[model samples]
Target: MTSLADTPKAPGALRYTLLINAAPQSSQASKSALRFAESLLQMGHNIERLFFYGDGVLNASSLTVMPQDEINIPAAWHALIEANGLSSVVCVSSAIRRGIVDTAEAQRHELYATSCFTSSEIGGLGQLIEALSNSDRMLSFG
Candidate 1:
């Protein structure tokens, strides 16, 4: 059977930025995207960033509660980004709308800690622009 690891690259392989717009379990979007990212890395390409927009912001939640038998998707993403030192950015506007505050935002709002962990940071749309400018390819797993 073909695997994501077998995906081909042309000459002058490109740098990629993955924009995940779906929740981890909302579909296979995030999971499949992440696995593809891993396969890209295995193939010796660079993922410039992983930008979580829309409902995808939930992947970085530190307070995510999943059943013991279920896969801990957040932790998996956290480990992957950390191990690769990849930039994982969550959309600030979307995150705030979904109650995914950062440490500073939490302190500012006088609320307890939010779901988003330290592995990902809350950033503006400017980061997305920058990622596009820097990356040769933009993959959308929305």
Candidate 2:
């Protein structure tokens, strides 16, 4: 059996940005992101940013309603990102397209995406590109 502890850590500090574009219902993207995040920590790498674009903006939407026994992925990701002090950005264009608006802006615009919805600040693809540029390595999970 392969033991996780037996593996040698990667040398040097690496920075990564995971751009997630897949929906929450899609197991592949989320799973891949989780795995990559774990691996980065294991390898002593830093995550500079986790940018949501296109359909990926859905990951930051607080409007997700899951069953009592089901996992709350967006919350999980948010917690992790906050804990790690990683930059979490959702594309403004994509967010609006999917009806995600921030608390202050939502009330100002009188548009509430959903009952549970809590919006993340809007960003753009350029922010993601900047993350990539700042990081040593950029990995796109979706």
Candidate 3:
């Protein structure tokens, strides 16, 4: 008899994509999603991308201000991406509307280039579609 842990993964590998549609402050969705992804990676799974959309684009904003007592969700994501080399992509339409601007977008829009954190990449819906297509699973948090 083979133990569950000893048995090979039925698909050999598992890849995941994550979509977050909630702001870090008003909801726990962003934090919860990150925690789950971290645990999955520790369990030897692969994370293809973390796509922040809707209000979740705030997670990529460099201008996010929080009280001293609160946990820094964006900082946590930055550390995780830096440490794990994970891909962090924010939806371009959502980000622009939410003031999460990268250098190029800021310049194009003639605004101050100071909103987006370095760990975040501004992308399109196509990125999410690609991730969903390639990954074994796509989990959403709102």
Candidate 4:
């Protein structure tokens, strides 16, 4: 197996912004995005931000419980984000509409609890625009 240290870093490592647009259980988008992010990091490329839009915001839900036989996509994402100290953003509009909320959001909306993972924050399109401006590439998976 090729280890991360064995993988040659790309010259002039590029910064990337990843956009995920599908729900974790509904499709391969989340898995694909995760794999790509791992590859980028292993190759010494910088991920500026992980932007979850549309159904992709589901990936940031802490309440998601996958079957024992299946992989826990959200947990995997959480681990990756934590390990790499990556910036993860779930679109506030999409997240709220889908019932995913951080603590502040939960209080703001007068909900009983927060369901969003701690590693991700509910943000707006402005974050996406800023990420795009700072990164060399923006890739979308769905």
Best by TM-score: 4
Predicted candidate 1 versus true structure: per-residue lDDT over 84-119, tens digit per residue: 778999999889888999888888889876678898
Per-residue accuracy of model 4 over 1-142 as CA lDDT, tens digit each: 2333344567888989999999999999899998998888898888899999999999998999988999998998888888878899999999999999998999999999899999999999999999999999999999
lDDT (C-alpha, whole model) for all candidates: 0.85, 0.70, 0.82, 0.91
Error of 2 at 1 (Å): 29
Give the clash count for model 2: 0
Could you tell me which 10 consecutive residues in candidate 4 have the lowest summed lDDT? 1-10
Candidate 3 stretches with Cα past 4 Å from truth are: 1-12
Error of 1 at 47 (Å): 0.9
Better of 2 and 3 by TM-score: 3
Predicted candidate 2 versus true structure: per-residue lDDT over 1-142, tens digit per residue: 1222234546786778888888777656975786677667666677778887777777787868789898777776666665555677888778777776676546766884442233245677899888888988877767
Angstrom error of the Cα, residue 137, model 1: value is 0.5
Q: Alpha carbon lDDT of residue 59, candidate 3?
A: 82
Q: Which residue pairs in candidate 1 collide?
A: 61-115, 62-115
Q: Which stretches of candidate 4 lie over 4 Å from their true place?
A: 1-10
TM-score of each: 0.88, 0.79, 0.88, 0.92
Give model 4's TM-score versus the native structure: 0.92
- Sorted by lDDT (best first), the order is 4, 1, 3, 2
Question: 26-122 in candidate 3: lDDT tens per residue?
Answer: 8889999978977777666777899999999988777777799987888777777767777889999988887889889989999966688888799
**Least lDDT summed over 10 consecutive residues: which range in candidate 2?**
1-10
The candidate, 1 or 3, that scores higher on lDDT is 1
